[model samples]
Target: MTVSLPTISPEQQHALQAVLDEFGKTLPGCSLTVASDSNVLFDGRSGKFDALEEETDSPRAASKEDVLWFASTTKLITSVAYLQLVDQGTLTLDSDLSEYYPPLREATRRVFRGTDDQGQPIWEDSHTAVTLRMMLNQTSGFGMEFLEGVQGWKSYSGKGTGFVNSCKVDNLIHTPIVEQPGVQFQYGNSAEWLGLILPHIVNQSTEDYMQQHIFQPLGMRKTTFYPFGPEFKSRLMPLRFYDNEKREWQVLDQQMPGLTLPRSREEIEYPVAGGGIYSTSTDYTKLLQELLKLFRTSPNAYPKGALLSRESVQSLFQGSLPESAKGLLAHVMNMRPPQPGDAAATGEWDWSTGMVVWTPADGRRLGKDTAAKEGGWGRRASSVGWFGAAGTMYFIDPESNLTFVCTTQMLPGDHPSVSTMRNALEKQVYVSLQA
Candidate 1:
């Protein structure tokens, strides 16, 4: 189902341009693009591609080819890669994680048994075993603090020392499980562990398997697990984040004095699969497009060939959270409060694979229903994607056959630039569809 590109109305074009301009003024150095099912509706960039301190005030133009780190957005890729193995019968989703890593087999399954000496958990040992499905859905009883807290797990710090000393994959196996596997949703690096498991099953390194099976086949030329040499540096846009003290945004350089740089090859080459990818908007969009095609059309949706069966895709999207997870991990993932008409009030959503599965009533939380009413077309549901630690986001909307990508560089995560850029782009998409 190839759709023809729609012509943009003058009003819609002006509205989009205005929003892009505002993003430039507010974010400092950033690039953005909005596309319909058929064609790019808007593309714009402002700020220097390199370190701002080295470049002049004359902002360098961002182009379609400029690559930006997709960050945690790489989780979707890791998820798909794992699913491919499942499809090939290399591993089963229900397989016990302890089967591969034997130490986990004996690790205590800790459950909340009330408060302890320091008001911590008084855990009781359990008989249930953690499985691949539970880990993929973020119900593996892993603690979120390892990734969220400032000092908990500094393995992916890019400093080269923390990963070797304190953040090794083996360390996670002995870490306490806060809840029973498949009991709740606590988003973190479980998927990265799953990535580590892939190489063991397929008899190849994660990078090699991804390149041979996914990236090369899908034509994701700019996507890589580790940073490319200086040749690729010319294509990368400098990361930017807002600095409240200066009342302006600052551009980050190679040293990343106050920003997040791409993870070093040493950090990524290890089993830290969850957040190791470096990608461009173009490369990431292709992966999203492949997922969109699978969900909207058929499992054999790609021009290259079928990546996974339709049934497999359905299984990936179904709920993996258990009833006991209600108050614990769910609150973290569902940050938005229940709106007046939210289906979550009726117990409709559940954690599935690498994203939250939204029922129709929960669509408002993601700005989908509002976009539809405003005449913007995209998936109100039946879509899922995530961003990197450094303010990167992507989504594939099956309803409208639209794949959206937004990339930026910001340190410490949760920088205002991410939300500001996403909201502006979403509004423009809505306005464009209405026109």
Candidate 2:
């Protein structure tokens, strides 16, 4: 399923190791690995898989194949499924969703005009319609209602209840686009809608469709939306995080919504497109390798039997946000009344289907030219950066045909250390490759 690269010189391998060796020093309880098309250049960890257990270090070092939540990287998989359906002509990006599904017509936009007499944020109606494309790119303009207690309805799927007051419904794809669609990118709960809609298109559950079409064909033995049975539990690593302030690793007691690690079948929530796929670095990389095939194949003709065609591959990766996305993100950062006074007044980041892409101007010191599409296409542009979450990060460098996946349960995901780890790894990786 994954392409294997030809052997490199021992000098190159040693250079690679030397770069990772320095990086291993920086992570006390984490795993770092790099892989090329043909071989794993490095697979080593300085910390235990169960970080909270002091006795579990060194001898219990993490492996590259250990099952961990890929977090939002799951979105890339979901996007692939959606794109596959698109390729099959099951759906169109710009079609009015409500026209196809009346339940979507039932949803409405809720704007926070200001606070009411009780001091809660006042809301108003927004008539903007939602679309499949907006859901995929996060530009449908939905906010994280769980954090703000937006008073949304709940779903009782027996697994658990999540606030479904999303622009999309809790267990349905009918929740209204509460914010103006196509205006700007805001984190929304459309992955559930994606999961919901894809099944509608193919008449198979999202999990089953993905399992049959993507996972089974790619030899992704360990990836799943939920527990298939007892064996699935055996390879799953426990959930834990490091407390920088306490200088210690602890079993994570305070978990976030949609977190699937170390939980029971009844305790897990429905697999949202944005999150909720338990996977290993190796298995997900296999999926990535499938995409890489699109780029590496001569591209004159579909690679005989490639899973997806070159045109769909280009469409999947080529859409980008408008010029207004940056300004809208900056406005949201500025308008947050409780934001720290010293916080930067501007923000930089955009969506590529389900992944977060960065441009050269976005401040990534890419060692080579990225040649990223600027716009004039759909809002689904691509970037050679990453799509990650509170516990994990995956980065792809198109110029070098390189990808790195870092898994950790670090909380408040935007922590300085996470960025530090990504930066250090990228810097070393480039240095090693050039050497």
Candidate 3:
């Protein structure tokens, strides 16, 4: 299991360093890492650990080991955990989630309808069942309030209450189904519900169960559901915010200015299985490496391994969303922007179990001009992975045996600074490979 780290060329290092420097100037404070198969090709840090002046007046440079929130990236990890149970024959992928929890049956049969801000019918009902498959594929029609209804649901009081309630298999019976499950792609709170199911089926706390099944087996020492100990403070990256008016990035300070210091570990500890894991780039990379290995080894091919059966992995990569669902998710991701005299531009993409799969030529949608190489073809087309709300992203390309993890702490998800830094780093990495 000893992996020999790859040697990074000095030229590659310098190129990556230049990208980081440019990002630091644009982003309030940032850190990044680029890794090939076994070795970290490039690692760079700039700015403070905490963006707030009161937290620390001086800029705290980010470190390779800084533990940052993975946000939605947690979904991938949670999905893996569930698959482990499937490996043990303790769970079934296609089993109506309601079979285990009756309230979920409602989830399977519900239809969601809504009125537009202008009192016009925005979305109509498309009858479908929200199955476990749909939830995993994100085609369950569960809308993500974080991105869509951020303003209204931002103040929703019940943070983890839904998970707590849904943990009871019986709760599934009473749970209201909002939308037809299998028809449309909606990145809602489905993963959180799935995470809650883990504890119920395993009869253990989610953290303890995942610790034994995933973290321990994979040797992801720095990855955890909650802040484990003092190590968190040392590894935690400072949260930064973009001051659009000032046209500058700044550390988040509650007293001096800006909003509160976001949520603290003490305030929320359920370790939202959907989006609440904090991890270092090194630790999270281990998870990605294991997944790559899983694909390489071609294990049981279904939900029957610590990772996934090669076949299951392949199925997960296959686009699961129908045309309707694909269109819905594209809108939710803001992948399409309104153009003059035309409807919002939509691309041909589909949601897999835990990743986005692109068919041939889909790279153009993401603004890529060239097609990917054979082994590297998936880089711009078919791939699976997720990024955090705090500017962290990782992608695994089974076709190329490549995995990349980039970490930074930028607040207000999708800040322009974070996007700029990520795009710059990704472009350099691709350029280096071509060279």
Q: Indicate which candidate wins on lDDT.
A: 3
Candidate 2, residues 259-331, lDDT tens digits: the string is: 4343555544445667668777667777765675575556565566567767666655554676666565545
Prediction 2 TM-score vs. true: 0.77
How would you order the candidates by TM-score, starting with the best? 1, 3, 2
Q: Name the better of 1 and 3 by lDDT.
A: 3
Which 10-residue window in model 3 sums to the lowest lDDT? 336-345
Candidate 3 lands at a TM-score of 0.78
- By summed lDDT, which 10 consecutive residues of candidate 2 come out lowest? 372-381
Off by over 4 Å in 1: 1-14, 33-44, 106-115, 118-123, 146-174, 240-242, 246-263, 267-271, 298-305, 316-319, 326-330, 333-349, 362-365, 368-379
* CA shift of 125, model 1, Å: 1.8
Stretches off by above 4 angstroms in model 3 are 1-8, 26-29, 53-58, 106-109, 112-129, 146-175, 246-266, 298-306, 334-347, 361-366, 370-378
Q: Please estimate how well model 2 matches the true structure, expressed as its whole-model Cα lDDT.
A: 0.57
- Residue-wise C-alpha lDDT for candidate 1, range 268-306, written one tens digit per residue: 336356666777766666666566556655435443457
Native-to-model Cα distance after best TM-score fit, residue 173 in candidate 1, in Å: 4.1
RMSD over all Cα atoms, model 3? 6.0
Q: Report how far residue 293 has shifted in candidate 3, in Å.
A: 2.4
Instruction: For residue 77, give model 2's deviation from the true position in Å.
Output: 0.7
